[model samples]
Target chain A: MTVLDIPSGIPAHVDTPAPGDPRLARLSLNQRTTANWDLREAVEGAVAAGLPAIGLWREPVAEVGVDVARRIVDDAGLRVSSLCRGGFFTASDRAERTRAHEDNLRALDEAAGLGTKALVLVPGGLPAGDKDLAGARARAAEAIAALVPAAVVRGVTLGIEPMNPIYAADRGVISTLAQALDIAEQFAPHEVGVVVDTFHLWWEPGVYAQIARAGERIVSYQVCDWITPLPADSLLARGMMGDGHVDFPAFTRAVAAAGYTGDVEVEIFHADVWAAPGDQVIATMARRYVELVQPHL
Target chain B: MTVLDIPSGIPAHVDTPAPGDPRLARLSLNQRTTANWDLREAVEGAVAAGLPAIGLWREPVAEVGVDVARRIVDDAGLRVSSLCRGGFFTASDRAERTRAHEDNLRALDEAAGLGTKALVLVPGGLPAGDKDLAGARARAAEAIAALVPAAVVRGVTLGIEPMNPIYAADRGVISTLAQALDIAEQFAPHEVGVVVDTFHLWWEPGVYAQIARAGERIVSYQVCDWITPLPADSLLARGMMGDGHVDFPAFTRAVAAAGYTGDVEVEIFHADVWAAPGDQVIATMARRYVELVQPHL
Candidate 1:
């Protein structure tokens, strides 16, 4: 079937919402969910799925060139929700740190070029052989502070994504919504903000309170379900909504009450998700969003 | 070789400290570290290794009977550092919750019989298909509250263990030291307190501050390293001290400064650790404790 054809073979359990369902108005298909799709195809697939916006990733955007990638999304009349990521600030070497800062600056420029105000920053993990978690965390904060000016100049907000603590060793040291807010609160809400990803923060006992406190500073709200018996690689542990334990309605309501009025991005990085037909993944994500999340929003 | 013989095959990289090393005065061997050992073997092993204490698990204790397990530790002159666990308090059904409560009361009695003041409480994860995280947590708190009087009568402290968020869905609902403190602080410090397991809590951004706040309420301090490429079974993700990313000296200092002057239990649950000779495991734990943790204390 063509990329535009809705998969007639979607499992019986999944609902195929009609295209342009009003309930899906805020839905944004993050590119990572359709891992096999190139930048153009992901954008077209999202458009075909009636998603109003698409979340871009820097790698795929760079492959086609950011300018062209922007044009493709613009041509499809789809908004760019937010850039996938831009931060690895925990390096100990001054030169490596400098390189990271420069890369993040470029990421800010790319986010601006893509017509998205949010640049998701995954403050990196500990340096190799370094056990100074506190020191690495301090460096992450300092790096974010350093980038605040560049982000503000570009009219982009540095969105601090507090990854799950499981990734604290090698992916992101910022591991909780409270910790993210601690750093983000250092600057004006418009210049720096937090990404409330349900998969990472759902386990937090104080998450709702933190979300409420996030208020207007909640720049991006990302969704995906956290399934258990985590595969050998914990990175692919996320499941489709309704297939896992997240109470999405409550989580979405908390974000809504916090005054975040923006595209709700669905970003999943599971192996099975990547292997699925991109069109089917979009259909599943859209249907899940409508059933599990939209009513609360 | 006899269980008492110190294996000469220990890798050269692992420091083999002298028996009864003064630096290991406060170290306790948690039974799970030597998963193959029975209650009697673990107690005798602790004695042979010159470790002053052993942390008991209910299963092994039950196998030999709590009274016999108590006598074994007493005869070996090894202090019972703490009991392995007691809480699975997140059941949604009334009868299951009652059974869990009854089981915990028996755990308290077991802790008392074993002569350990601390009973580590792993507040359970969500019931299958349950999406209410807050409800699970609340049930956990209520469960703890219900057991407080029984714990007081048994002179056993309920140590709330804030497991890593990775285990929040299946192992424990309590996922942060701060969250554990929120539940523990509701009762008298001696009746209900917290377990600071390095492997579970080292990733928390506010760990140090929470450690200070835990102060006299810190009932047990368990140590283990968190290694990467977590095996498929995240439950076996723990490693020996100094084997992974935890900074034990800093962590030990935080607990020491928090006024927790108790046996520091070495609780590892990795497959490699379990497969090793139990005597060698004890020796390695003692040596690592001396080099990586005891100095700080």
Candidate 2:
């Protein structure tokens, strides 16, 4: 209803800007946001809503059978912008790491089959029973190096998502976009660039400069508003746009200006949001993303 | 107890360096880590544990006269290393910011009265309904500048505690140690440095290098461990010493090598740890800090 305030550099998409349904405008769904959401329902909803991209996870794809997931995605005319994740590469044992590399190869195969742009990665957290973060990072780099050739053959760039430090213990040790990008460049220039997710990165001291530096290499960007005083074991409690104090409008605007024309996907992980009807949650996010987030284009 | 293969380079303090009770180390109790462990009980526990310092909060002091709190700390020979917090400096309105400046002065008086070395700061999250993080940080700096002289007069450095990104929305905007030190240098080097808590900053990308860079400017140091997929709200779920995967030995070594000789306080916030008796919690922490943390010293 209000004039769309999409940031300066983005296209109006005026021809289909609102299309009377915000769902039609943004079609990507981040699988991890609401951990409890059913994978099948997610796919059906994306199809029903005319979303163009549906991010897939290796576990879900494997569980659902790649063919079935591939059929669903292809039939829905959805582009798999990214796979849920690959790369908990740090391991104390060589056998586990080799197994991981083989598993990653399988993941690459799955991604090629699904036709996603990049395998979104959360390079492993601190190694089990060990406390060498720098060493864990080195192990992650070595794992990435081991997998790069397979990824190249698969024709995909590995998107390294730098998670927030709150997860530095067990989630992913790569905790900054700059750190991720630096490591990414060391391996291969076009092969990697950091995946800038607002939830993981909004608080990063030099987030803006990193985004500007990312430029075309960014390729994939994710959005989730940050909420504070998070419940211990913070599996949920993410705020919807405009609710939390995150500067989403400026956040999206910066990267978009940096030339990432991909979808500004909405990713939420609030327990409240997950418990609600999926459609209702998506509807709310779609509306807000268009209203507040779209304003920054 | 059998000697676990302790990482080398750390000194041995595990032989009960103090006396009969191994339960008298953790130099202070962080109020935020324990709910309902009020100012009086906290100080009493500190005195019993032979703790030299305490991290106090404003609310408890307000409820029970500041004069009373001040006397208890001094009488017990306990130092108020740093006031719990002050610096929700992010505000959309100028009036609110000006009021924050006024509150900061009052905090300065409180710090002076308690003879605290520093006033811990949790710089405000984003401006209300605004999306400019840089701007919010600028406002925080301005507020610090306005309040620095008052802090200087009292010989209290506004100890900036760079909280984790999980707190970027509601609690603090200062998300990294390097940025905080930069802000300290810019505004008033002598008036500010930082309160380095491994809990909040361990995952910082360039932390090791920054610790060395921070040099003698680190006014305080704290520790707690992070668990992954951090609690939906991470206010709780902090791991105790030797509990979580934090490389505490390496962390303290970095700080100590950086020329810091301050106390290595264990600041935990797990529900499991706090549910037990306060005395019991302090005893375990003190014992563990000696066995585990002191080695890294």
Candidate 3:
């Protein structure tokens, strides 16, 4: 189906799929997908939408207090699919690096409290005014290694997210699945792994092979569509499924073939998607998931 | 130095370094770098700036006619570094594909007449409304194979340009150096090669290794910096050297080590760079090359 077939804004009558809908058995709503919702609202929204799980972000979780956020998700009977982040440790300054490490440790604790094994780590980009890409990447690897013990102690798997290259300069230096695996493989799979986010990796020519190579090292499988005419703020360039050029069936099949049976988190970061009503956004993603991605999974 | 240190607009005194300036001996001003300059103007600009070579774009060459354009450069004692285009053959429509092939053949003839062996090929992106990336890439490979005989006859090498992934959906599907080499390697080194552009490839973790692997198959080396807060139109995201995060010294060293002895073409597409006086832009790029990239080369 073409992107034009997908509806915009809220549908007149949004139907929440049945709680036990087999199609959404492994589907998850990443909090960022509903950026307008607070921690409690996000959890309640996931439950109301009949979603089995919701991915939590540190900032929102911190606002409601980790204990309260955990209790809310538990009370709603929704699983914590993964934590939004924790890893910006490419700082060259010793003090800054220490602060990042401390922050990550706290993130791990929060992830543990949320009862999720996956803690997505966006390896920091190049330091300001620094043109040393290799140096930045080396620091990321070193930082990931340092976090392994803490991650293992908390029963959390650090999911090294390979962001799109457009963000390599200012957001994340790790820009390829192979680069992420190179570091993840250095440790036990349980201690470290990779996040396979289609939006970030769809353009990779060797993505299928890399997915296969990832095997059990795959920690989280995030889904989002890459739309063209990227927004002025590139961070919000993601589109709802079937509303962009991504071949979701092929990508989902590749991740499934890689033996990644973890929660398939739908994490969109589009300005329009954010502006839409949270329930409508959930309804659209769920419907698109069933039509475009879940069948392949 | 930071981007602030780089001068903006027209410099007060733009010196045209002598033709014998060893530091600029290998530098070629790509026509796009001076977007406003026409064929004759660009050729004369190159000569006035004491540049040894100039990269030609098809439209401008067509404006003055290839033969006339060729004579203009020849009379000015400037070499044609490479031709700007030719290759958008990923169309599924048979007629469209046929048209693309005919146009590419014409481009090959233009490159040959211009006395340049390098014909940069930007393999087209996915067909409209198509989500089949692998299918699009397969078509690109088939199209390149189909054009090989003509490229050989024209004594021109098809330099497959792997554009940054951001353009994979609409501009070019070939998004990695390895992917470009994969297609180029099937043919004789002289018949098919790859263009190594810093702006398009600086984020690749394996770029240095890929450049080394390219070896004799490397046809052209293009330079431009990737600036952040990418303009509303991503096409103009390139920055002046030292104004962005790319490490020119390392990139140029890698290309040089790859045994590339061709012109290092400066191909910026930023609005600010395009708005600046052509001579000032040329002068600035030359200075940046000498300070940041020439030493490494």
The segments of candidate 1 whose C-alpha lies over 4 angstroms from its true place after superposition are A1-14, B1-14
Model 3 chain A weakest 10-residue run by lDDT: A1-10
lDDT of 3 by residue, B1-297 (tens): 122223343342324355678888888999999999998888888888779999999999999898899899999999999998999999989999999999999999999999998999999988888999989899999999999999999899999999999999988999999999999999999999999999999999889999999999989999989888777788888888877889999898899898989899999988888887887788788877877888898
TM-score of each: 0.95, 0.87, 0.95
TM-score of chain B of each: 0.95, 0.88, 0.95
lDDT (tens digit, per residue) of candidate 2 on B4-123: 212211233344234334344335666655556888888887667667777788888887878999888788777776786788878979999888888888888887787777788889
Report how far residue B285 has shifted in candidate 3, in Å.
1.1
Q: What TM-score should be assigned to candidate 2?
A: 0.87
- Give me the iRMSD of candidate 1, please: 0.9
Q: Per-model i-RMS in Å?
A: 0.9, 2.4, 0.8
lDDT of each: 0.88, 0.73, 0.89
Query: For model 2, what share of native contacts is present?
Result: 0.94
Q: Give residue A212's error in model 3 in angstroms.
A: 1.4
Q: Candidate 3 local accuracy as lDDT?
A: 0.89
Candidate 2: TM of chain A? Answer: 0.89
RMSD of 3: 2.8
